[model samples]
Target: MEMLSGAEMVVRALQDEGVEYIFGYPGGAVLHIYDALFQQDTVNHILVRHEQAATHAADGYARSTGKPGVVLVTSGPGATNAITGIATAFMDSIPMVVLSGQVRSDWIGDDAFQETDMVGLSRPIVKHSFMVRDPRQIPEMIKKAFYIANTGRPGPVLVDIPKDHTAPHNTFPYEYPKKVKMRSYAPVTRGHSGQIRKAVDELLKAKRPVLYAGGGVVQGEASQALTALARKLNFPVTNTLMGLGAYPGSDEQFLGMLGMHGTYEANMAMHNADVILVAGARLDDRVTNDARKFCPGAKIIHIDIDPASISKNVAAHIPIVGPVKQVLEEMLTMLDEQGEVGTDTKSLERWWQEIAGWRKVHGLRYETNEQGPMKPQQVVQALYKATKGEAYVTSDVGQHQMFAAQHYLYDRPRQWINSGGLGTMGFGLPAAMGVQFAHPDAVVACVTGEGSIQMNIQELSTCLQYGLPIKIININNQALGMVRQWQDMQYGGRHSQSYMESLPDFVKLAESYGHVGMLVEKLEDLDGAMEEAFALKDRLVFMDIYVDPTEHVYPMHIADGSMRDMWLSKTERT
Candidate 1:
C-alpha cells in the first residue's frame, strides 16, 4: 500500500465511501484539500455562490437520494455560513458531512487570520463533530463521520482540520473501519413486544382511533411498513406537512393531512380520537394547535427513533424508541398475529361520508379570467396535472408552499421535498438542483415564489454548468404572498410594502442565463408550456407564471387558539 498526505488520504477516504460529488467553496485555509481534489479526477465538485447554499444543496442531495451529502468550505465565515444549512439538515434528519478547513494548528490560539472555533460552534446542530489536531486521526475520523452521519436518525457531522494537518507526512496507513463505536449510541433494533402489544390493545379497545404519521416515515424509509400497519389495522391515517406522501391520499383509510392547513375531517378526527398511534410524528405545535386540548380523549402511543423527540414537545401515553422501519414492521407483524383485523365499517363509512361532504364544500377551486393574474390554486392544479404526479417536487417557503402541500397530490413517499421544520425560504432552487443530480432519471420540479426564488437564483448557473434537467415553475406574484395573506387578514386591510415596485421579466432573466424560458398568461397555456419545458432534454427550463398574491391558505390555527378556531375557508375565521 502506498502512503499519502493527509489531504490525499481524505480524498481517498471520500472516494472509498462512494461520494461522487461534493458541493463547496474554496478559501485560504482549505487550499490543500482543493489542490488534492484537483489532482484526483474521480470526485466531482460543484462551486456554489454562497456557502449556505452549498450545505443546503448537500442536504437536498442527501434527502433525495438517501445518501450522506458531502460539503466542503474553508475557515471562519465559510464555516459559519454553512451553519444554517447544517441546522436545517439536523432538524430534518438529513444525512450530511460538512468538512471545513481551519487555521494552522500552531496559529489557532494566536488569533490567526480566518480562524474560528468551528467544531464548538457547530456542535449543537450536528450529530457529531471532530477537530483534527493530529493528522494521524484523519482516516479514523473520516470513517467515523460517515458512519455517524448515515446511522441512527441521520444528521450532519462536521470535520474540522487545521491547515498544517492537511499537509502532514504520509506515514499513517489508511484502514477503513467497517463500523464506528460509540458508548451512548445503541439504536433499538425493533419495537418492544410488550409496547407493541399494548398499542394494539389500545387501538382495539378505542372507539375512535387515528394513525398519525410524520417525516420520520420518509427519513427512516418506513413508508411501506407504515402503510402495512395502517391497512392491516383498518384505521384512518393523517400526516403532518412533512409526512405528505407517506400514506396514499386515494386510500380509503387515508385522511389528507393534519395541521393548521390540514383537512377539516383530519383535524376533527384528531380532536375526537380515543387513541392515537403516533408513528414517526413529533406532534409539532402546528399539528397540535392547542397542545393541552389536542386529541382530547386520545391516549397517544409515540414511536420514534429519536428518544428526545418522544414526549419532548407533547406528552405521550406510551413512548417507544426504535428505528421507525423496525418498529413499524414489528407492529405490523403483531397486528397480523391478532387475526382477522377489520375496520369499524359503520364508523369508517360515516367518517368518509363526512370528509367527502367537507371536501366538496371547501374544495380547492378558483376562477381563471384569461386576462390578468392566475389564482395560486389554479397554477398548482395545472402544474400537478401536467406533471402527472411523477415528479420530485420541491418547494420554497411561502404561500405557494402551503398551497402546493394542500392541493398537490403526491402518490408516493419522498416525492414532496421541502423545508418543513425550518421554513427556510431560499431552499427551493438549490434543493431541486440537488434532487435532480441525485435522481437523474426522474422529472424534478422546483416550486417557489418570486420573492423566495431571488434568494438563491445563482443556483441556475450550477444547473446550467452541470447539465441538470430541472423545471423551475415560479409563482411570480411580485409580492411576499404569505406575509401579504397574514397582513390582509389581520392588519385592517392595509397593504404594506409586500408588493414590489418593479418586477423583472423572469423569462428574460432565464434567457440571460441561456436557459429556455416560457411564460403563461391563460389557464389553457399551462399544459402546453409545461409540456415544452419537459420536452427540453439535457438543459434547464424556467416557467414564470403570474399568480394572484391575494390567495391565502385556510383552515389555519391562529396563535393562542384551539383547533376549533381554524378558519377552514376563505370566508371564515374563528
Candidate 2:
C-alpha cells in the first residue's frame, strides 16, 4: 500500500470504484478534497447551483444508469439543504452515496463554525450513515457506503468525514476492499422455490388477472423479465405512477397507470380483477385510498425485495420476499416446465372484452379542443410526437406529472423519471441534466409546471456551463393546478393561496439565461414549437406553453372510496 494524504485517498477511493461523476458544491470544509479533485483526471466533479440539486442530479444518474450516484457537500447548510433530495431518493428506493465534509473532530461537539449534526439530521432519510474519525477509515467507509446504497431496497447512504481527517499533515495507507460482506446485513436474493410454485398455481387458476407493478421492477432491473412473464400469461398490466415505464406503455396488454389520476381502464381492472399479481410495489395510499377496501375480491400475490414491505398496508396471500428480477425469472422458468395452461380461456376473453369497454371510457380525451387555451394533455402528446417517444423525460410534481404519465407512452425502462413518493418540486431541471450527462447523444426533456419549475429555475446557469441541451417544457396554467382542483373540490371553491398571480415571462427568463425560448399559446402552435425546440440540437430551448387554466386531472380517486370510483371530469368533481 502506498502512503497518501486523506484527501488523495478520498479521490483515489472514488476512482477505484469506477465513479465517473460527482455532483457537488465546494466550501471551506471540503477545500482540501476539492483541491485533490482538481488534480485528478478520472473522476469528474459537477458543480451544481444548489446542494439540493446535487443530490437530485445524483439520483437521476443512479436511476438511469443502475450505478450508485455519488455526492459531495460541505457541512451545515450544505448537508441540510440536501435532506429533501435524500428523502426523495429514500422514499423511491434509488441508490446513492453522499459524502459530506464535517468540522474538525476535536471541535465537533463544541459547535464550531459551519458545523451541524449531519448524521442526526439525515438519519431518518438515509439507509445508513457513518462518521469518519480516522483517516484510515476513508476507503473502507466509502466501500461500505456504496455497498449499502445499491443493495436490496436501494437508498441513499451518507459518509461524514471530519475536516481533521483530511488535513494535509495526515497520511495513511489506502486500499479499497475488493468485496465487502457484513454479517448483520445480508439481504435475501432468491425466493423460496416452493413459494414460486404456489404463486404459479394461483396465477394459472385465475381468469381475470391484473399484473400490477411499481418502481421496484425498474430499480431491480426486472422490466424485461416482467414483460416476458406478463405476455406469456396474456394478463392485462397496470403500473403505478413510478412504474410508468416498467411495462411497454404502447403494448395492447398495458392498461396504463392505475390509482389516483390514473387511467379509467387501469383503475377499473384493479377493482374488478379476480386475482392481482403485484410485483415490486407496496400498495401505497396514493394507489389505495382505503387499504381495508382495496381489491377485496382479488387474491394478492406480492413479490418484493423487502419482507417488511409485503402486506404492511394491504394483506398479501402469497408474499415472496426476494429480488424482483430473480423471482420473476424463476417464475418464468417454472412456467416453461409446466408446458401448458389448463385454465378456462373463455373467462380471459370475457375479461379482455370488459377491459376494452373501460378503455374506451378513458379520461384523456379533451372536453373541447377547438376553442380557447391549449391543453396540457395535448402538450405532452406533442412532446411524445416531437421526440418520437424516444427522449429521456423527467418531470416535477403536479398536474403536468400526471398528464405526462397518462399521455407519454414509454416503451422501455428508465425513460420516465420523476419524484413519485415524495413528490418533490424542482426535480426536473437538474434531473434532466443528469440524464443528459448519462446519455449525451440522446434527446432529453423536462416536463414541468409553472409553480414547480420556479422552485429550481436558477439551474439554467449550470446547464449553460455544462453544455447540456435539454428541452424545457413549461406547462403554464397560471395557477397551482392540483392545489386549486383539490381546494375547489374540498373547500367549496375557495381559491385562497392557489392562484399564481403575476407569473414571469418564461421566454425572457430563458433568454436572460443565454438559451433559446418560445411561447406557445395556441393549439395549432404546440406541435410546431415542440418540433422547433428539439431541432436545436446544440442549444437548450425553453417552451412556455400557456395551457387552459381551468383544466384538471381526471380519474381522480374519491375520498374513502374504492379504486373504481373517480371524478372523471371537472363536472363530476364532488
Candidate 3:
C-alpha cells in the first residue's frame, strides 16, 4: 500500500482523533490541505466567510463539545486572520488545533509568495506550535498538538506544514506521532500531601475563609470536588468569570462571579477573607483590582495545572501545581481520613443566611417602564426567564456582553461563550451558530450590541444556509455602547460621533436572509418574543431590542480598577 503525504497524514491523524468537523477558508499555500480533505471522508469542513470567523467557530465547537476544534487555513493572511481567534481561545483556555500551509522548504525566508512565519507569529497565542519540515513528522506533530491542546490547561495549538512536505513520493510512511516530547509539559498530579495538609490547617485556623475558584475548576471538571472541599471546610466559593459554573448557582456556598464586573458581595468576600484557597484560575488584572490591596489579610494558597500561572499575576503563599480535579479529590480524601470531611449543617446554615443577606442587598434585579424602550438588563433577564436558564449564551463585546455576564445565571461552564480575552466585536453571532450546530438539542442565544452586530452581520447568510436555529437579540442602542459610556463618564459628554446616525432595520435584514425578524419595543413583549423564537424550527430569528442608552452595567470595575472599586449604581458613592 502506498503511503500518504504529510497533508493526508494530518487528516488521517485528525480522523483517528475523532475530529468530525473542521472550520476553514482555503488559500494558495494551504491548497494541499484542502485537496487532501477532498480525498478523505471522515471530517466535514465548514468554509467560513473569513479565517477569523473560522477559528472562532472552531472555538465555539470545542467549547460546546469539549473536544478539540480543528481549523485549516492558508499561509500568510490566512494565518494572520486567525490570530484574534487564537488569542481569544488562549485567554479563555479552549482546546483548538489550527493548521496552516507554509511556503515550500526551498523558499524559506526569501520573501516567497504569500509566505509568513506562522509558528513564530502564533507562539504567544498557542500552547504549542509546530512546523513540519518532513512529511513523516506530520502525524507525530498532530498527535502532539491535540494532546497539548486537550490535556491539563486547555489551549490552542498550531501546526504549520511546508508545501513540499505534502507531496507524495516521500520516504517516510504515514505513522502519526504517539506522544508529545516536552520535559516541561508534565502536569502535576494530586501528590502534594504536605501542601494539602497546610491548606486544611489554614482553613481550620482562619475565621473568615473563602474558596477562590477560577476557570481551571471548569477545565478540570472539578465542580463536584470543589463543592465537596468547600462544604467540608465551610467556606464560601466565589468564582471568577472563567469559573462561573464551578458550583451550581443554587448551592448555598456558591458566591456569584468575581472580577471587574463581579457581584459586590463576591468582591467584598474576597476583601474580607482571612484565608483564600485559590483553585484552577488565573487571578487576572480584572479580578485582583488592586493586587497589593486584594485580600489584604488573607493567606492565599494557589492550585493550578500550569506552574507559570501560579506566580505570574497574583502572589500565592502556598502554590500547589497539579490538575485541579486531582488536587481537590486528594484534599477531600485527606479530609475524610482526618475525620474533617463532614459538613457542619449549622454553620453552613448560618453561612447561607449571610449569603442570603448579601443577595437581598446586592443580587441583580431591576425595574423598567413597560411602555418605553427596553432596558438591556430587562431584555437579558427576560431571556433568562423565557429559556428557564437552559440555553447556551454567547455575547459580542461591549456593554451588552457585560450585561449578560451580570444578569445571566449560566448553568454550565462552557455554556457562556464570549470573546473574553480579545473582547472581539462580532463574536456572538458566529460563535452562537457554531454552538447551536454542535449542540442541536439546546437553543442558543447571541446577545450583541448594535455596533458589534454589524461587524459580522454577513454571517446571517451562513446561519440561514446551514438551517441553524440561533436567536440573535440585538441590543440596538445605535452607538458603540462602551465608547459612548466612556465618553459620557470620562470625556466631556460631547458624544464625538460615538453614536451612529443611521442603523439598518435588523428585522428587514433578517427577512432578507429568509429568516424571521421580530421588533421588540416594550419590556412586556420580551418574553413573548423569546418564546416565539424558541418555537421556530431550523430558522434564524433576529430580535431587535430598542434599549436605553443611559442603562450601564452597574457595579462596574472601570478599566484598570480593582474588583473592589466598583460602582454599585449611577448615584452610589464609589
Top-scoring candidate (lDDT): 2
Candidate 1: tens digits of C-alpha lDDT, residues 343-409: 4667766655656665564534444566767788887777788788778899999888988888788
Please, what are the lDDT tens digits per residue for candidate 3 over residues 312-375?
8778998888888888898888778878454445655565566666667673555576566678
lDDT of 3 at 263: 83
User: What TM-score do all the candidates reach, one by one?
Assistant: 0.96, 0.99, 0.94
CA deviation > 4 Å runs, candidate 3:
168-172, 340-354, 558-563
Report, for every candidate in turn, its global Cα lDDT versus the true structure.
Answer: 0.83, 0.91, 0.81
Give the per-residue lDDT digits (tens) of candidate 2, residues 319-380: 99999999999999998887885554788899999999988886667775687888899899
Candidate 3 TM-score to native: 0.94
TM-score pick, better of 2 and 3: 2
TM-score of 2: 0.99
Top candidate by TM-score: 2
